[model samples]
Target chain A: MTTNKSLFLIPKFITTPSQNGVGRYVCQLQRVVLKFCKNHGSSRGIREFIEYDLLNFANKNPEVVVYLKPRRHRGPVIKAEYLNGDDQIVFCHNNTREEIAKWLNLLRTQSGNHDGTRLRKLWHTDYPSIQGPWTPYTFRDPALNLAEFPNEELSRPLDQPKTATEELDELFKKQQESEVAESSEVK
Target chain B: MSVLKRVQQWATFARIWHVYDATWQNPFQSAELLKKYLMGIHKPIYHPMNDCGDHVIVINSLDIALPGNEWAKRVYFHHTGYPGGATWTLAWELHRKDPTMILKKAVYNSMDGNLQRRYTMERLHIFPDGNVPPELMGNVSNQIRQIRPMPKRLDHYTKEEVEKFPKIIDYPKDYILR
Candidate 1:
């Protein structure tokens, strides 16, 4: 039970086999029902679609069972059933023949009724990383495996500048070289 | 999951053991450094709710340095939950009682006051000196660098090195001995 209201009410899912089209394509729509009145102004476009395009649609997809229900004084409706035990309904009342055909094609291509559900991710991957997941020893130096703990060299902070003692030593060496050169010239 | 993926999951969440040398380092600064390792903040997969913290073994805690006058000014307070039971101990006095107490308190106080603070502190192992047990020392795979360099004492250097060092001035024969 999630505290989020939207997440709790609506189901969330990743793209699974029910929505995949990778290797082989399988039509998920199992059946479709077009219900329209026999003699009504609203059913005019649906009747026209049934007379002109219904045969071609049925012939193209033999897997889907298309049914026609002629009712009296009823608005037109398109109902789609999927193999995943989910169904979708679209009201085609007063819709044009072209619009009805487009709706039927959309319902036929979808894997299932994904409305009222949230998509967890936009993309999916079988292998998340090319190299591998990161580990503690992934970028670590191999020398640490053989070295002893509390090592002075490893414990010291890096990039320290010269100290006063070192500076004084350098100055003393330069002065001594100058004195040696003076003595050599005199000799 | 396959065996390889299971092993990869374990590798990503593995609790690493790190060693830190506290010699000649300030306790407060070292505490800030050690807190990150103890809480697993140094890892790439760190999450506030996840248990990904690593173990830290801190050695040479007895040699920890405190800033000027901190040993005298800093105090630890305690109450016995009774009337007239309040007590305050100076930092130096507390350190004298327990060599590891200063650094331990430092790391403890550096973390947030959450339910996981006590559990996170449990992973920190502080020793008074470098005499750590062989079993614990064997698990350490990484070392935390000290914040400050360890200054070399004059007596620590060899007699020859000291004598060969450049002299700034020569003392007069009539100079009075201090």
Candidate 2:
């Protein structure tokens, strides 16, 4: 059961992986430092990804700096540094070469922020209302300002249609008026 | 909310809204207003490529007004690509066929022709009437008031109320009103 979970979390723009630093997104991972044991079983995958795919990946994304550090009798760990001064550390043990490469790619694409924070708004804007922000006076007619309130004509609906009976009465009155004018002309 | 707080939020985080009422409102003017919210043009963070727009929910679109003689004069045209497959529909006829299409077409045509236009339009949710689904209500953080006031319905008026209303002229005793 999701008990009041919606109120606790904030929504955000998951650091849009800056498309070549277009101003909206900034590359989260500036540098990645990989630490692994030279002779350990867990170090095998890290060693393989670095040997096979590391060079090509580095050539493709020259922006991210990669460093490989070898230690003795320790587990393998990946440290990712972001442009926002935030650090993400991941532990990789008993993982295959493919999985290690996948993790490296994930780190490269991320903006270095964890999920589940509160989002103040669903949308954001830089240039609000090109026409203008609406106020009480935005679309108000200038004539309304000069007119008095509770005026009968203004209060009534403008496009109200005439009732069938009223229409018939008006038609009959028009016929009578025409008949009277014709009688006078004949006289 | 205070003006200062609203200005601060405009500079930072402004949420989306669902504004429905279009009763007695000019469709052209209404389209202009819709375009502002759709493109996120109403916020300080608006960008051409950046998707920094807010979601807009429109309901009661059937009652949107077309000022002057636009209902008779304004026309919507479309083609099926086949020979003599073209069709031109008047504004009133289109509204009679589908109430939502007029507003939708108006908003669609008002947007800039760009690759991101379809994505921007996705943020706009329009409904024919007042029945908004349960799922979409969660995203609506505010309600924007309609530009024109909704006219009073006939059913809301009572016989006593009508009798009490002031009259401009009093007819003679011999005169008969049918």
Q: TM-score for all predictions?
A: 0.72, 0.44
State the weakest 10-residue window (summed lDDT) of model 1 chain A: A11-20
lDDT value for model 2: 0.74
**Tens digits of lDDT, candidate 1, A1-187:** 7566665536565665544576767888999999999899999999999999999999999989999999999999999999888899999999989999999999998888877777766677778789898889898998988888779999989998888998998999999999999999999
Clashing residue pairs in candidate 1 are: none
lDDT of each: 0.91, 0.74
Clashes of each: 0, 16
For every candidate, the chain B TM-score is 0.93, 0.79
